[model samples]
Target: MLETLLTHVASAAEATGETTEASGDIMSSLGIDWQMLAFQIIGFALIVFLLGKFVFPILLRSIDERNAKIEEGLKAAREAEDNATKAQSKIDDQLAEARREAKEIVATAKDEATAMLSKADEKAKQNAKHVLDQAHDEISKEVIAAKKALHNETLELVASATERVIGKTHSAKADKAVIAEALKGADK
Candidate 1:
């Protein structure tokens, strides 16, 4: 069966205008001799081992360093963002506090001004009352003086009329005594 298959394969190869070489000659011409192949394989294995052991490790270390630096930069950026947020919050709080303080100051000043105004009004009223009392006292004194003058004039007129009726010439001394007595009686 193997011979029949080989014959048929040969015929097929001839029909395709190609011939297959024997395995031994193919292997020898391709330099795939076991001993030489083994040496070549060992050399390639050594080169791969060296690259993996030294060069690859250095490359991985460099890649890791770059990654670490990138991560650190991201962390720093986050920290900066957080700090900025905190600063903004603090500024807002301070601004609000300032506004509150300003309002309180304004209110206090307004209250003080109102109190002062009220005090001024009270003082003005007191001063006006004092002035009115002094005016009343002065007017009362003037009225009393006028009434006393009128009473004296009435007595003088009566004395003159009585003298004319009796046809007596009254002396200055007598007139003075009479007026004095009349005034003393009216004093009661």
Candidate 2:
């Protein structure tokens, strides 16, 4: 097609009586070849039509799908981040509550221990008092028994002395009078 167009141009130039050199010079200067230019324009238009019909739409759809996937991934990432934050908050709350409960348990245990200690002290004091009272009662009884034994020993000694001094056993009334007189003399 380019060769045929060039031949026609040469024929037209000859019919006008223009020399080949002059026509070549004019064509170079103008830089115009209408037929070749028209063909180039048609080829460019066909290529644009074919790309728009097939390749461009496919590329565009792929880009749109990729963008949608990216957006979905971003949304999922945001949701996961929010869930993590909520889980952390819940854990912190539970930890604080557990700490509070532990403290209360410790305090309650301390209180119970203190109360038990107080009760033990009071019971020990009561037991000590009871033992002391029992000891005092036993000591008083011992003192009374010792006094009775001493009195009986003194009466026997006086009766034996009176019988020895008088040289014979005395009447009961006489013994009683003599013993009373001796006890009075000892007091003086």
Candidate 3:
């Protein structure tokens, strides 16, 4: 069936005197010229080869460079963030240490103050006790002196009264000795 169709198409082309070797039955039917098709294919391949060798490489290199720059920028930003975190951590540690030290200092100061106050209070108590003891001793000494004076005066008075009752002058020393004997337990 295809052979008969080709023969009819060839006859028709011969009648028209428009057939050539480049325009075979099938190619002419599809309105394709072989030499012109070959030229177009070669032209398209040349264009692809040129773009691959020159323009494509340049464009790809530029894209690769851009990607590298973006990666570097991201790395730098991450490093900066990490450094900031580390610095903040250090600051926090320092603050904690400082607070701890301050507490220690305050505690030490309070302890010292308490000790000093206790010592001062003890000293004051000791001084007050000493003063009270001294005052009591002085009062006891004064009372003893006053008692001796009273006993001496009473002995003299008794000696004079005994001399008056006897109607005769006895020895003064003898009378005084007798009065002291009589008042032996009474004076105390």
Candidate 4:
């Protein structure tokens, strides 16, 4: 086809009396070269075919593999992040549970202490009451003994005075009877 067009252009140039040099100038002006254009087209087609057959598929497969690897890495990272979050949550829950347990222990301790204190207070009160009752009993016994001693001393003094007034000592039975009569009269 290019040759046919070139031959037509040459004949027309001959009929117009244009020389070969003018025809070459016209071709140059048009920037047309059959052999070079054909070689360039063939080379371009071969390069396209080679890239499509070998280079393009390899490059596309490599890109796809790289994208898959990146996606896998992203998935793994997301899973790790989720696992870290779960671990943190578990730790937080454990800490909360520990704190709650500590609080409960403290509360129980406080309650136990209060109970112990109450028991101690009650025991102290009971001991104090017992001691006070013992003291009262001791005081009563001492008072009764003192009163009996005073009565015995008075009886002896009265018997001795009566013996001195009469200028004679009385028998034991008579002394007791006289002292009894005197005591009875004093009571009246």
Best by TM-score: 4
Q: Model 4, 11-48: lDDT tens per residue?
A: 66555444445566777789975445555675587679
TM-score of 4: 0.60
Ranking of all predicted structures according to TM-score, beginning with the best and ending with the worst: 4, 2, 1, 3
Worst 10 residues of 1 by lDDT: 13-22
Write down the TM-score of every candidate: 0.52, 0.60, 0.51, 0.60
lDDT of 1 by residue, 16-104 (tens): 33233345477778766544454456557767887998899999999999999999999999999999999999999999999999999
What ranges in model 2 sit over 4 Å off? 1-49, 160-188
Measured with C-alpha atoms, the lDDT of residue 145 in candidate 1 is 93
Judging by lDDT against the true structure, name the best candidate.
Answer: 4
Query: Model 1's lDDT to the true fold?
Result: 0.82
lDDT, candidate 3, equals 0.82
**What RMSD does model 4 have?**
8.7
Output the worst ten-in-a-row residue range by lDDT, candidate 4.
13-22
